[model samples]
Target: MKTLFILFFSIPLLSACSGGASKINGHPNIVYILADDMGYGDVSCFNENSQIHTTHMDRLADQGMIFTDAHSNSAVCTPTRYGVLTGRYAWRTRLKDGVLWSYDEHLIAPERMTVASLLKKKRYRTACIGKWHLGLDWEKDEEGRTLLTRPIKNGPNANGFDYFYGITASLDIPPYLYIENDRVTTVNIDTVEATSGKGFWRKGPIGDDFKHIEVLPRLTDKAVGFINTQSKQAEPFFLYFPLPAPHTPILPTNEFRGKSGTNTYGDFVLMVDDVVGQVMAALDQNGIKDNTLIIVTSDNGCSPLADYNELAEFGHDPSYIFRGHKADIFEGGHRVPFIARWPAKITAGSETDEIICLTDLMATCAAIVGVDLPDNAGEDSYNMLPVLMGEKIAHPIREATVHHSVNGSFSIRQGKWKLEFCPGSGGWSPPTPEVARQENLPPIQLYNLVEDIGETNNLTQQNQQIVENLTALMKKYISDGRSTPGSAQKNEGETPLMMD
Candidate 1:
C-alpha cells in the first residue's frame, strides 16, 4: 500500500516536470510586414472588386486571422510607425505635425521604449529591413555639407535593432541611398535631378545604377537574405519589414507591370503580393514556418491620388465604402489591412472583428515573452494574445483608440462611437485646399460606427448623449498619455473640444 501511493504520486509529479521542461508549444518567431500607403480595398481578400489578385496576401488571410475593423494609429507613415514601435500615440510626442524628412534628426528619442528594445530584452534577435521612414541622423561633412559617404547615428542600431538595412524616408526623398547599419551601401556625390522614372516619385539624389523600378524587388531580396542568415543562429528573431511600395511614384517591376488589369497602382500592389510570397517561401525553406508569426498590414489607407482618375478609370475604389482617403479622419484614412499567421498558435481560416490597433504589438510581444511592461512602456498597448488565439470572446482588449491625421487632426474611437475634432477633412485637404471648409459643416463630427461604417450620416446633431460620452473618453485618453492601458496624463494645450 505504501509503495503504491508513492508510485502514483511520483508518476504524476514526474509528468508535470516533463511538461514544464518542454519548450512552450505556442511561443513563435514574429515577422511584422508593413505596407506603405496600402488601401483597404487593395487586397482581393478584403475587397471583392479588387482588380489585383494578391494570392500570397490572400493566402495569409485564409490561413490566419483577418481583422475587419483594424486600424493604424495614424493616417501617415511616420506617425503610424512611431505608434507601432512605442505603443503610444505619435501626437503625444514632439512631432505633433507632419512627418520627418530624410535629413532630419532621429525621431525616436533614445530613452523612449521601443518594440525592438523590448524584444531584445527577451533575447530575441531583432532586425528592421526595408523603408525606414522614421527619421535617422545622417553624417555630415566638415563644411556642414551632407556627405552620402559618412555613417549615420541614432538609427535602428541605437533603437535596439541588431541589424538594419533601409532608407531614411520615402524612396522619393533626398539622401536616396541604401543604409546598412550606420553606413550607406550606395552613395552619390553629384546632385541627381528628379525625373518621372518608371512611374516612381522623383526627388533628391539617386545613383545612376539605382533603378526606381526595382525598389520592391531589392527590398524583398534584402529581407530574404537576412532571414537566410539568421536561420543558422540559435536565437529567435523578429523582422520588422516596412515596404515602400504602392505609395507615391508607384512603380511595379517589369514582371508585375501590366499584369494587374487595374493600372499602375494595381500592378504595384501585385508586386507587393509577390514580395509577400517570396518571404513566405523563404520561411518554408528554412523549416520555421510553423514556429513563425507573420503579420502583414499597412500604415494607412489609400492615397488621394489613387482615388483620382486612376481609380475611376480602373473601377478600383481603394477606400472601399469608407468616406475619405489617407489624410482624412474618416475610417478610410486609418482603417487598414491586418493579417496574422502563426501555424502553431492562431486558428486557420478565422476572422476577428474586434477593433485592434497597431499600437498593441508591443504589449502583445511582452505578454508572449512573459515579461511585464513597466508603467511607462507600452502605455497604449493592450495584450491581444487571448483574442489572437481565439480564446476571449466578449472581453474586448482595447477600450478606446486614438487616430491622427497628416495635418495633426485627432479622432478617437470608443466602442461604436467615433469622434473627430475637426469639421471638414483636416489633412490632405487642409484649410488651403478647395474642399477645406464646407460652408454649412459643423465644428465637430460624430458617427456611430456600429450603424454607419461608411460614415455617411453624422450623429453629432442627433446623438448628443453619445457625443458627450465619447468626447469625455477622448479627452481623458489624450490628457492622460495613453488610451487603453495606462493612467491619464493631462494635456498641455487648450482644453480638448467636445462636440456636445
Candidate 2:
C-alpha cells in the first residue's frame, strides 16, 4: 500500500470548505445502507407527488440532510457498486459496458484500496451485509467448472471487509445462495428454474434454503444482528448494507403486498422503506442511534422492469420529473435518493444541492477518520465532509463529474452544462441503436440542464465552443487516468477516443 502512494504525492492537498460547526467528538459507527434500482422520486421526501408511501424513508430525511443533486457513478448496478466501493469510475476498468454475470471474474484488482479497506486502517470493524454485484473470484473444480463450495478469493472478505454475508449477484442472476465470510453457508445446491415476466429473474441453480421472497428480510435480520453485536464491542464499526430489493424478482412479502395500494413494485419500495426503519430501530435499541452516522441511498435509478407504464396509470411515477429510467444517460437513470443522518454532527432536516457522486464516500470517510488518501486511491472521489456536516461552502465540491451508462456511453456535467458523447438515450430507451443510425441523428448531444431540467431540447448545435471545451476536458480526464488533480496514474486499460 505504501508503494501505491508513491506516485500520488503530486496531488494537491484538499481542505474542507468551512462555515458551520461540526460536532464530531470521536469516531462514530457508520452504517451505509444502499437500496437497489430505486429512483430519486421513489422516496416521498424527494418527490412530493410520489404515490408510494415511504413513511420510514421520509422519517430518515426529516432526521438528516437530503441531497437534491446526487448520483451514482454509473447507471447500471455492477459499475455503480464498483464505483461505490473503489471510488473510481467503472469505465476506467476493462468492463466498458454492461454488467457482470454471476460467474464473472472479480472486478476489483487485488491491490486497489476500497472504502472498507480505508476504514479498517482506522480500526473499525467493517462488514458488507447485502448484494455484491461487483464480480467475485470463484474457485474452480477438478474439471475446471466454477466451484461454489470452495473458498472464494478477491471477494468482500479479501477486499478489506472483516466480515461479509451477502449474495454473489442480483437476485435474478443464477447460483442463488448465501455466502458468509468467504464460503457458502449451505452445502446443497440443486438446479432450479423460476421465471416471471414482471420480476425478470434468470433460472439457475439454487441453495435448498434460499427463497427470493425471504432474501430482504433475511438480509435485514443479519444487518440488525451485526449492529447489535458490534455495539457491544469497544471499537467503532462500519456496516456497508447494499440491499437487493426493488430491482428484479420484485418479491414483496405477503404482509406488504397490498400495503402501497399501487402495484407489487410500489409495495416493494414500501418494503425497502420498512427495512430502513428496522435498521434505525435496531440502532436505537442498541443505544447507538445518536452517535451512528446512518446514510440511506440507492445504487441507481429504478429499472424499467418495475413497469413504469403501469406505475403511471396508478398515478405513481418512479422517475418523476426526470426523463428516462435506469440504464440511460438521462438524470432519471443515475440520479438517486441520497440522505445522511449524523445526529452529533449534521444539522437535522437540512437540504443541499451539492453535486456529488456515490464514489465520493471513500474520500468523505477518509476525512471522517482524518486520514490523507493517496492519489492512486479514490481518483474520482471529492471530499464532501463539509457538506455532510452542514457547512456552507463558497465553491462547488466537484469541478466536473462523469456519468456512464449501460452501453458505455459517456456524459460529463460541469455546473449546469452537460455534454453527452452519444446520441439517443444511450441506453434501453427509445431511438434504438438501429433507429438512431437510420435516422442519422447527431453523434453527440449537449444540454443546458439549468434551463431544461426535462432535457426536452438539445443545445449541441448552438453551443459548439462549449461542446469543444467539454469534449477536450473529457479527453483530458480519461487520458490523465483521474478526474481529480493528481499525479497521473495508470489506467487498467485504454479508453477509446470515442466511448461508443
Candidate 3:
C-alpha cells in the first residue's frame, strides 16, 4: 500500500493545475462504456428537455464531470471507434467515407498499439464486450463467402484484447452473431428477414442464440460478470463495453416499452440507461467503484433511425440546440455527451468545456498509466489528464479538433472558429452538396461556433482570412500525417478530398 501510494504521488501534477483527490493506487480498473449511435441530448443531464428519462446517466453526471464540448473523432460509429482505440483519426486510414459493413476486413493493423494492447503491456487483463463496428477479418469458407468459419483472422482479440464478446458490426448489419474470443459461440446459422423503420434490421444470417432484443441485456450481463470476476483478482482489468443499442431495431424490453411516454426510440434510450445502471451496480457490488474509472459516452450523434420527426412530436430533439444529426458535418453529428467518473482521481460533480475528442482517450489512458506514447502511436491524440484533474491550464488541450462526416467531408475547429470543406450537411441530412450546388450555396462554409452554436449563420464570405488560415492548417495536418507534434509520418492511405 505504501509503495503504491508513493509511486502514484511521485508523478508531479501540472503546476498550473494544482490540487486533486488522493488516489488509492496507481493502477485503477478502467471500464470504457461506449454507446452506439446515441445522441448528445439523449441524456437528461445533457438535455433539459429530453423526452427520454436517463436516470442512470443522470446519476453518473452527478458523480462525475460533464464535458459540454466533447466529441467523437468522427460522426459515425466505426470511425469514432477507430479513433477511440488508435488515437488516430479514421480519416487517416483507407476508409475516408462511410463505415465498414458486414464481413469487412479488420481495420486495426496487427502491429498497431491499441488501448487494449497498450494496457496489456502494463499487465492489465483486457476484455472487450459489446459492439465492435470496426471490421473483423472473419475466417471464411471461401474467398467470397459470407458464411462463418472458425479462427477469425482478426477481431478485438486479435487487436489487443485478451478476451472479446460482442457482435462484428451494428445490430442492424447482417451476419449477426456473437463472438467469444476468436470464435463464434455457435454455428447454428439461420436467416432473418429485413425490416425497415423504427425497429429496422437488415436481412441476413444470424446465430441461433443471437436475438436483437436480447443483445443489450446480454452485454450488460456479460459486463457485470466480467467486472465481478475481475474484481476478485489482484491485477487490475480494462473492460471496453460498447453497447449496440438505441441504434436500430430499437428494442426496449417489455417492461420498458412505452415507458418513456415519447416513442419506442425514447423507450430504447431508457433501456440503455438501465444497462448503464447495471454496470455501475456491478462495480459497486464488487467494491471497486472508487478505484474504477468508468466513462459512458456515445460513438456519435443520434442516428436518423431514431425517427427525429417522431421524437420531436414528444418535444424532444436528440441533437438539442445543435443543427444536424448523425453522419453530418454539423455539431449535431460529432458533438456527443462525455462524462467520466473516477472517485480516486477526479473531482465530483465538476464540469469542463475543454474541447476533447474520442481520439484523445488513448493519450489520456497512456498518461494515467505513466507510459509515454511512442511517436508512431496516438499520432493525433492529446493528453487530457491535466484538464480532467481540474488543473488550471494556459490554453486548450487540443490545438484544433478535426471532425469528419460519413460522406468524407472534413471540418476543423480551433477555439470558436470552424471551417468546413462542404456546402451541405455532409451526410444523410438536408441539402447535400449536389443540392447545395443547385441552390447556389457556397462551395464551402465557416462558422464561429461561439456566436452560432446552431451553425445557423454562414460566415465564410465575411471571414476569408480565418477561412484561409484554417484551410492552411488543415492541409498541413494532412501532409504532416498527424495532428500532434512528432517526426513526419506517412498517412496509411490517401486522404479523401484534400480540400475544397
Give the winner by lDDT: 1 or 2.
2
- Residue 399's lDDT within candidate 3 is 93
What is the clash count of model 2? 0
Model 2 over residues 1-500: C-alpha lDDT tens digits?
A: 00000000001112222211122234656777888898888888999999997898788779888889988888888888888888899889999988998889899998899988988877778999988877888888789899888898888988889999999988899889999998999899998777977666887889988988899899999988987887667666778888888888889988998899888999989998888888888767766566566777788788888898899888888888998878888888888888877776778999998899988988878877788889899999999888887777999999999988888888999999989888777788776445777798887888888899888789988999999999999999998989988889777777774544
Query: What are the TM-scores, per candidate, against the unseen true structure?
Result: 0.90, 0.94, 0.94
Per-candidate clashes come to 4, 0, 2
Q: C-alpha displacement of 384 in model 1, angstroms?
A: 1.3
Candidate 3 TM-score to native:
0.94
Q: Rate residue 346 of model 3 by lDDT.
A: 74
Error of 3 at 121 (Å): 0.4
Error of 1 at 492 (Å): 8.7
Tens-digit per-residue lDDT, 412-498, candidate 3: 999998888888888878977567767877768899899899888999889899999999989889988889989877777778553
Q: Rate the local accuracy (lDDT) of all candidates.
A: 0.74, 0.81, 0.81
Model 1 Cα lDDT, one tens digit per residue, 12-57: 1123322211122323456778888888888889898877788998
- Model 1, position 276, has a per-residue lDDT of 85
